[model samples]
Target chain A: MRSDKQSRTPMGLKIAAGLGLAFLHLPLLLIFLYAFTTEDKSYQFPPPGLTLKWFAVTWNRPDVWEALGLSVRVASISTVVALVLGTLCAAAVSQTRFFGRETISLLVILPIALPGIITGISLRSAFNLAEIPFSFWTIVLGHATFCVVVVYNNAVARFRRVSGSLIEASMDLGADGFQTFRHVILPNIGTALLAGGMLAFALSFDEVIVTTFTAGQQATLPIWMLEELVRPRQRPVTNVVAMVVVLVTFLPILAAYYLTRDGDQISGQGK
Target chain B: MPHAVTFQKVSRHFGSVRAVDAVDLEVEAGEFFAMLGPSGSGKTTCLRLIAGFEQPTSGHIEIFGETAEGVPPYRRNVNTVFQDYALFPHLNVADNVAYGQMIRGVGKAERLRDAEAALEMVKLPGYGARKPGELSGGQRQRVALARALVNKPKVLLLDEPLGALDLKLREQMQEELKTLQKALGITFVFVTHDQGEALSMADRIAVFNHGKIMQTGTPEEIYRRPKTRFVADFVGSSNVLSPAFTRRLGGPAEWASLRPEDIRIGAEGGHEARVTGSSFLGNATRLTLDMAGEKLTVLLPAGSAVPAPGASVRFSWEPSALHLMGTET
Candidate 1:
């Protein structure tokens, strides 16, 4: 017989869980709703009308395309730089012991832990002091500072989880340093690096504070949307762009979650 | 022919802890050599040194006459079956076994065939498609053996390879390993903390204590004539008699060892003792006796009459059974 008493969740807990989820996601739902609303001047709850006009409008805007292209390029380059730097840092910190190893790891993760504005201000001053002109690379540099922290956090955790014997066994079986890394280390940590890169890309795509300090005249999508918010010009178009941004960032985060949820189930874990 | 491995005054110290201290060891070619010790007794450290995983702090080591101090593990002609099996979790049984050959630039088809043959040798044939995690503990251990054997290394180092199995499987593997070692004619250097395992499987056993070799000899020599108190106490629960007790027992005033099985109960004109405890052990009955403030153990045959606890009894051994040893610590 089915044990209904134990199997079913209490009603109060179910209601509380539903309320908690709604509280967290209702604003995102509103942004989606507003994107389809026909009235572009202001938000009207239970919208006065609804139409597919804003999607067409957003599709034709050259300024929107330019902002998107810039954001994609910046996020891509930032993620690449972060992957190389973060994986190396994680490998060194996790696989070896040296003076101030813990402090160095803490410093690598400090950028993400601090407020974005703090990182933004310090990066801007450092760039200015170095006499480097603000450009696309400058924005990439700013994003990579925090992007590296995300990748490092993921990669370091995975590196620690991999058993040291795996590498030793590879070497014992006649593999050299490079061969062992390729055949053993890479397969063990590959999914973790991929997940870290995905998260880093998502973080860089929606970043505004760091880009504001680093970009001289560049208007990334978020910066462009911020400007459009201040000066009302077809507000639904901005909501439409916001909808696209949500989808773009959300997909990667979702993919990363699925990739890492069962990561502990890696073969030969307890053995 | 040169010895398969040799250590000349080798010492490996981890800071203040001397893991393997100034030990000279030699393993002849085509022999199954076992290093037996308790935990922290340096048996594992010696195995790592032979594998080139750790360098000696201040000593010379040679493997088949090659200077082995600075050589990396990959450059050495040796393979290891780790205590935990250390099978590659991500690879299937076949790929894991084929790993060594794959590194030597052997063709895929040839390596896989050799891997299958290795599995057959370990009695795990046709298990190549299965991952290490899917195998039982005994099966994983066999896979590890197959992986090491596939390389055809001159020396095979086993770090307590059967330590994880249950009693029945352990005994089975012990025989299988001895047979395999004999068939291959490769020098096998096995490390283990279990004394019975060392006695049963090793052609020669080195008893280690406190980062030093207490005694090194054949299993029979170690069992019948231990060189020191540590070797006597560690290797079979042999009764270690103090110098005073040995003198009273009509022997010289020196430390000596008496095997439990050597004591015959109900012998005329022998030491008088009272049984403190007695327990039946399948093939034998073990009785703990106290004689004149000295504790002694006697192993009675299974079908023999066993005395009840607190019973007074006379136990004795032949004079040759009392093996005396030096005063070295």
Candidate 2:
């Protein structure tokens, strides 16, 4: 049926789809092209020459490495924390019923639903009011607030799909609660968690607004790139870093899509 | 020996809805006991109670003479083949069958071998490495059986295990399951709404209605002599004669049940009835009759002349065939 529809798709719709793709990717294409341009200070079409020199300059910058290390660490720690908290929250909210269960889930997801600036300001004020020092941990905490929503969304969907009978069968077969989780529940929800965690990682790695409010003295990779765009430093180096950022963020999203694309293929699903 | 499972006035209530109300039951060891009822009649709830999945709201339960209140399903000496054959979606057949042993800390190789033997017992010997999704419905049902049977529990609870299979496959599994139960001598508590299945497979049957057991007896007893109108109407299609109809038949003015097969057509001194409908049932011809303003059904043996819809006929049964029933409980 999908093939039948694809075969009959109007020519206008096909061209419109192509245009949509180009509109989304054209800026990234420009970033790629300018990363190799020889010009240093100004934007120009059809550069006089392209060189690998900017790539080398961007590679040798110690500030680049420091910011890159900080961003990776923050995203990594935030994703880990999100996976644990998000999966637990998803399990509780989907698998049981109690007073305020729906409200608790909504609050869990509210951080992502609100604008990033709102979450950033709230975190900053919360830290100030508590007299907690702003450092690497503060940025991680801010990123975790939203990262958990991503994992919770994915894990909750998968949790709801796992049949209640499967859990009962496990208990009937002599599995304790912990053993049932390890053998039955974990394998069923494993892919969803992985996909959710990868998405959380990508979102955290490129985050800017929350990090701007949470960071006191440290600069993440995105913050570094934002500052470089305003300054008069070698321009192609900024484009070079943009290329790295695109690759770092794009790969996990791609991997996440592949992991969950056939999510409905779990055994005994419809049976 | 103590009964395989005993329930003394067990009642499971959910928010004022009595799912199982004041039910007393005893399942003998090594006998195939069936709980037969329509959907929401509490047969499945009773099975869950014995499996320790649902604790009774009141009264006591025992498994092989041991008190069973507050014990979790994992601690019980019973396993259930769920209605949908709830095989783990992530595991292959061998691992699924081995899950019970694995939880007991049995070595991997030994459990796998035992799983294979259990699969063999279910007549699905080698098809263990494949995932359940790859197998057909009947095969998944067998895999579920193997998974539950590998543990060698004292009681095996089957919750409409063959309900998903086609008619031909259901009949085939029914034969295989009855033989397997007798061979293993494990107490089998089978729950199903199909009266034919319960009659053929169970050594004793408990008929349920409105969250209570209407009758508990051997197949012959339940079929030959039902105690209430609900049991008579449910166990098999019977003509529930009103008190007026009973008096017209020269019996006391009380509710009575007469089996359709027991009524013989074209009998001398039989009550006159008009044939309202007739249908061929392969081995027997079912004739619907309107006798004295009450509906009656009679089975004519194959090769007998079936009366037309407007034809008038007379049918009668021996006095012993008319089983008197008590008031509705």
Candidate 3:
């Protein structure tokens, strides 16, 4: 759906954008290139020869499986928690009025606004003060804090776009409170919630900074990748795993962007 | 028999602004009643009160002799056709029309059957599968009407439901609505700011202004015998013969409303006037006359000689045409 206006963008601006995109994605392209490299000991661009060995090595490693499993579990749990808390918070903030509403909304988004290391340190300190042990749950709780903000940002924008009259019309047409929410309000906001949940999952999946403070003696995939980078065990296998990481995070964010891009026009607007 | 709707001194206020102020109204069963007013005139507020969307600040409402206090709109035996139609975007026409029945736990086969029947009633047969977005403005309006009518409520409330349509479509819907009301025998409470719409469709109309009802009567009674200056000006085209101007014309009344049609153009009447201006309407000529510098409008029927500006002419009305406005007006 490229518009005529977009096609008519100045040649200099288009070339500049192409250069910027190349600058950002060249490193990612290198990662994909090296995933097939035969060199296991030393790193070089355009590696001496290409082989399928690293993909097999990553698939066979028990340690890689454990880390991958933990990362998936943590992201799943965090996104679920975020979806519930974020959607309810969004509905309350957008649909109702109370004292400190703006302050509460600002506070909801505060965790994502602060430096991730700062959020990590405060969370670590809080857990230490409470005498809570760092386990799988702790990592999930830390990720949930930031994940909730992503979900909330998406949900609030969508909730505000829904017309109030639709809800009232539902009620007037003989739907009770819960019925109206199910039939009218849910249909209007369902796509937004799904998009928000996908984004939250993507954010939680690749999270590394907060996981550093909250996870003790447990390695999520990103943590595993960081340790393997320092220790350098079968380095190309790390590159292979990084490709997996990229795909897992990329798909949902792509999907979420598409979902919300056309979300402003909810069902049954203008013909 | 109980009236279809009744408001016993109802009022609704928002902070210091009185949206509906001490309104007492009744609509007989099976009557086509229209609440007519300008924006912020509290007519919409009154309709909302009956629909149970807004509870009265004081007093009570009765639907078919049962008090509407503490009743939700769903629990009330009435349905509303919203101004915007408010069709469910996700649902097709059948599912949308079947929503109330679905809420009542009716079976799929039965509700779908009823939905099709309702659509047929609105002359939209075989439109069950189409989305509301695919329909024209008039088609969406019919779907809304079908959705509300499927539940078979004792009363139907419409808040300017035809306002979004063009003039030709609106007039057509007006006739269709009147015929449907006659066939169904269900009370219809319609709200509109358009005066012509009320006059054409309503069996009786309540004219509202500043949160109070100015007058309530049949279309003819309200038009021919408006009690207040507001009603005289708001209801239709009428030249208010003020006392000072009446004295200049040597008439008896202090304040009276003279209908444009009542003043004949060339009928050899007593008073003399200079034709200041006129516009040719297809079937009639609306002549603007300056009666000793006071402006008066005369609606001369077709085939009558339309006088030019500055053409001196004689005109007058029978005593019956002068509707006086006493202090109560």
- Higher DockQ: candidate 1 or 3? 1
> What's the ranking of the predictions by DockQ, best on top?
2, 1, 3
lDDT per residue, candidate 3, B1-329, as tens digits? 99999999999998899999999999999999999999999999999999998999999899999999899987898999999898888788999999999999999999999999999999999999988888999999999999999999899999999899999999999999999999999999999999999999999999999999999999999999998888998888699878777666666657878889998766576789898999998899999998767899999899988888999999988878878786442
Q: Write the per-residue lDDT of candidate 3 for residues A1-271, one digit (tens) a residue.
A: 2864577777798899999999999999999888999887667866999999889999999999999999999999999999899989998999888999999999999999999999999999999999999999999999999999988998898778666667777887789999998988777788878887887887888889999999999999988988987875588888999998888678877876776666545353533
lDDT of 2 by residue, A1-271 (tens): 5965767877798899999999999988999999999888888898879999998999899999999999999999999999999999999999889899999999999999899999999899999999999999999999999999999999999899788899999999888899999998988888899999998998998899999999999999999999988887698988998888888677877877876765556633434
Deviating ranges (above 4 Å) for candidate 1: A1-62, A97-106, A126-133, A234-236, A250-271
TM-score for all models, in order of appearance:
0.90, 0.90, 0.87
Fraction of true interface contacts that also occur in model 3: 0.60
Candidates in order have lDDT scores of: 0.91, 0.91, 0.89
Full ranking by lDDT: 1, 2, 3
lDDT of 1 by residue, A120-215 (tens): 899999999999999999999999999999889988987886677778899999999999989988887888888989989988988999999999
* Top candidate by DockQ: 2
lDDT of candidate 1 over B1-329, digit per residue (tens): 99999999999999899999999999999999999999999989999999999999999999999999999999999999988888877788999999999999999999999999999999998999988888999999999999999999999999999989999999999999999999999999999999999999999999999899989999999999899898998999899998888898889888999999999998568889999999889999999999878999999998999989999998888999999985543
User: Interface RMSD (C-alpha) of each candidate?
Assistant: 1.9, 1.9, 2.0
Find the 10 residues in a row with the least total lDDT in model 2 chain A. Answer: A262-271
Candidate 2 — which residues are off by over 4 angstroms? Answer: A1-26, A29-62, A97-108, A125-133, A234-237, A250-258, A261-271, B327-329
